[model samples]
Target: MNSGRLTNFLIPLLAVLLGVIAGSIVMVISGYDPIAGYSALLYGAFGDSYYIGETIRQMTPYILSGLAVAFAFRTGLFNIGVEGQLIVGWLAAVWVGVAFELPKFIHLPLAILAAALAGALWALIPGFLKARFKVHEVIVTIMMNYIALHVTNAIIRFVLSDKSYKSEEIHESASLRSEFLQSITDYSTLHYGIIIALIAAVIMWFLLEKTTKGYELRAVGFNQHASHYAGMNVSNNIVLAMVISGAFAGVAGAMEGLGTFANISVKAGFTGVGFDGIAVALLGGNNAFGIILSALLFGALKVGALEMPSSAGVPTELVDIVIALIIFFVASSYLIRLLLTRVKKEGK
Candidate 1:
C-alpha cells in the first residue's frame, strides 16, 4: 500500500491492539482469565455459521447508520437525530407496507422509498432552519429527535396500536424476508439486506468521491462562504446533504422493520442506533468503505458481548468498555500519528 494508506491502516491496527491490551489488564485485575475471555470473544463472534449470520444482521443496520452520520459529517453537519429519524423511517415504511396492497415488485420498493422520503422530510426541518435562520443544526437535530419520538409514539397509538407494543406485521408481499436464504440457514434472520447495504455503500462512495454534486456539497461543507463566493449554492447544498443523510438513516430503519422486526413498535426509549452511528462513523474515518468495516467490527463486538457474560463469565459490559476505549484512542488521532512518527524516526 501507499504511505498514507499504510499509515491509516496501521493507526487503527495499533488502536485495536491497545484496546485489547487494556481489556486484558482489566480482566487480569478482575481475577479473570484474560486468555480465556479473549478466546471466547473471538469464538462467540465467528465460531459458527449461525453467529456469522447474526453478525451480518447487526452489521446491516450499523452500515446504514454509519453512512447516515458520515454523510452529514462530510457536509459539516453533526446529525444527532439519527435515532429519531430511523424510528420514524421504520414506522413510515411499515405503515405503507401494510396499508397498501400493491404487487411485491412495487410494494417492496415503495416501502423502502417511503422510509427514505420520510427520513429526508424529517431531516429537512433542521436543514431548513439552518439554511434560512442560521440555527445550529446540532440543537435543532437534537430537538427534532424528541419530536420524532413523540410523534412516532402518538402515531403508533392512533394508527397502528394493538395490545402489543408492535404494530401489525407488514403484508407478506411487502416484507423483505429472504425465505430461501433463511431456509438454507435453518431460519436464521440473515437476508438480502446485507447485499443492499453493500450496494448502498458503493453508491455512497461513488457519490462522494466521483461525482460533481459531491464536489459541490463537500466544497460547501469545507467553506460555505468561499463556495458561495465561487457562485455555488451553499444553502441548497446544506439542505441536500441533510436530506441525503436522512435518507440513509431511513434505510437503516427500513432494514430493521422490514428485514428484522416486520413492523413498527413502541420502543422503550430511543433506539440508540443513531447514536451508535456517530461512533461508527468516527471509527470508520467517515469513509464509505471504512464505515462498512467498522460497522462489522462493532457488530461482531455486540454479538460477542452477548455470549461473553453467559459463556465466558465476563460481564457483557466489558465489551462496552473496550469499545469506549477504542473510540477514545481513535478520537485522539494525534497520539497515533505521534507514535507512528516515533517509530519512523527510531527505524531511521
Candidate 2:
C-alpha cells in the first residue's frame, strides 16, 4: 500500500491502542489487574471452539450492519435508520418464513429477499426526502427509527393477535442453520449467514471500487454539485446509496431473525446493532476490508467482556469505555496527526 493508505489505516490502529491503554488505566484505578483481565478476554474469545463459534455468530450481523453504515458514509449519506430498516426487515423475513409453505431453497431465498426489500423501501423514505425535498437524511432517518419500531409492534399485534410480542417461529425450510457448522462449533449458533456476510463484503468492495455505477455514486458523495455539473444524476444517487445501504442492513436483520433468534420478538427499544455498526464503520475507516477486521475486533471485545467479570473480577463496562474512547480518538485524528508531525520534525 502507498503511504496515504498506510497512514489512513494507522490512525484507526492508534485509536485502538490508545483505547486499550486508557482501559488499562481505568483497571488500575479500580484496583483490578489489567493484564489478567485482558488475558481472560483473549481466552474467552479464542480459548475454545464454543467461544470462537459464538464470537463468529455474533459478528455475522455485525459484519452486515457495519457494511451498511460504511456504505452510506462512503457515499456521503448518513443512514441512522439502519435500526429501523433492520427491525422492519426482521419482521418481513420472519413473516415470510412462517406465512409461506414453500420448498426449502425457494422459501429461504424468498425470506431473505423479503428482508432486503423491506429495508430498502424503509430507507427510501428518507432518501426521497433528502433527494426531492432537501430534507436532512439524519433527522428523517432518526424519526423513522421510532416509526418503524411502533409499526412493527402494531403489525405483530394485528397479525398474531394471540401472541402480543412476537411472531411464530419460522419453518425449518426458511431457517439459515447449518447443522454441520453448529456441530463443529460445539453447537453454537454459527450458521451459513457468515458465508453470506463474507460474500456480501466481497461484493461491497467490488461494487465500490470496480464498477462504473459505484464511481458515479462516489463522485456524488464527494460533491453533489460537481457530480450534477458532470451530468451524473446526483439526486438519484442519493436515493440509490441509501437503498443499497439499507439492503445490507436488512440482511443483517435476516441473520438475527432466521439464524440467531429463529423468531422476531417485540423489542422495547432499538436493537443496538445498528448503533454498534456506526462504531464499526468509523473504526474500519469506512472501507470494506477494514470493516471486516473491525467487526471481528468488536465482536471479540463483546464476547471477551463476558469472561472478564467472572474470571478476573473486572467490570465488563471497561470494554464499553474502551470502545467509546476508540471512537473519540478516531474522530479527533487531527490531534494524532499533529503529534505525529511534531515527532517527525523532532527526529529530523
Candidate 3:
C-alpha cells in the first residue's frame, strides 16, 4: 500500500489493539479474569462449525448496512436514516414475500427487489428536500427515521392484523434459506444471504471504483460547487447517491426478513443494525473489503459476548465499552499520526 493508505489502516488497527488492552484492564479491575474472558470470547466465536456459521449469519446484514453508510459517505452525504430505511425495506420484503405465491426463482428476486425499492424511495424524501431546498441531510434523514418507524408499524398492523404482532412467515418459495449450507454448518441459521451480501459488496466496490457514474457521484460529493461549475447536475447526483445508498440499506433489511427471520415483527424502537453500520463503515475506512472484515470482527464480538457472562463471569457490556473506545480512538486518529511523527523525530 501507499504511505497514505498504509497509515490510514495502521492507525485504526492500532486503535483496535488499544481497545482490547483497555477491555483487559476493565476486566481485571472488575474482578474478572481477562484471559479467561477473552478465551471464552474467542471460543464462542469459532469453537465449532455452528458458531462459525452463526457469526457469518450475523455478518450478512452488517456487510450491506456498512456498504450503505459507506456509499453515502462517499457521496458526501450522511444517511442517518439507515435505521428507518432498513425497517421499511424489511417490512416491504416480508409483505411481498408473504403476499405472493410463485416459483422460488421468481418470488425470491421480487421480494428482494421490493425491499431495495422501498429503501430507495424512503431515502428519496430526504434526498429531494436536500437537493431542492439545500436542507441539511443529517437533520432530514434523522426525522425521516421516526416517520418511517410509525408508518411501517401502521402498515404492519393494518396488513397483518390477524397476527397482531409480527407478519406472517413468508412462503417457502420466497425464502433465501440454503439447506446445503445449513447442513454443512451443522444446521445453523446461516443462509444464502451471505452470498448475496458478498455480491452486493462487490457491486458497491465496482460502482465506486470503476464507473463513470461513480466518478460523477464522487466528484459531486467532494465539491458540489465545483462539480456544478464543471457542468455536472449536482442536484441529480445528490439524489442519485442517496437512492443508491438506500437501496443497499434496503437489501440489508431483506437479509433479515427473507433470510434470517422470514417475518417482520413490530418494534418498539429502531433496530440496532443501522447504527452498527456506522461503526462498521468507520472501522473499514469506507472500503468494501475493509467493511467485510470489520463486519466479521463485529459479528464475532457480538456472538462472543453471549458467552462471556456465563463462561468467565464477565459482563457483556465490556464488549460495548471496547467498541466505543475503538470508535473514539479512530475518530481521533490525528492524534495517532502526531504520535507517529514524534517517534520518527525522536528516532532521527
Candidate that would win on lDDT: 3
Q: Which stretches of candidate 2 lie over 4 Å from their true place?
A: 316-319, 326-348
Off by over 4 Å in 1: 330-348
C-alpha lDDT (0 to 100) for residue 142 of candidate 1: 93
lDDT of 2 by residue, 183-245 (tens): 998998888899888898998999999999999999999999999999999999999999999
lDDT of 3 at 271: 87
Ranking by lDDT: 3, 2, 1
lDDT of 3 by residue, 155-221 (tens): 8878865649788999999999889989988998899999999999999999999999999999999
Model 1 Cα displacement at 268 (Å)? 1.7
lDDT of each: 0.85, 0.88, 0.89
C-alpha RMSD for every candidate: 2.1, 1.9, 1.9
* Model 2, residue 318: C-alpha shift (Å): 4.4
Return the lDDT, model 1, position 329. 64
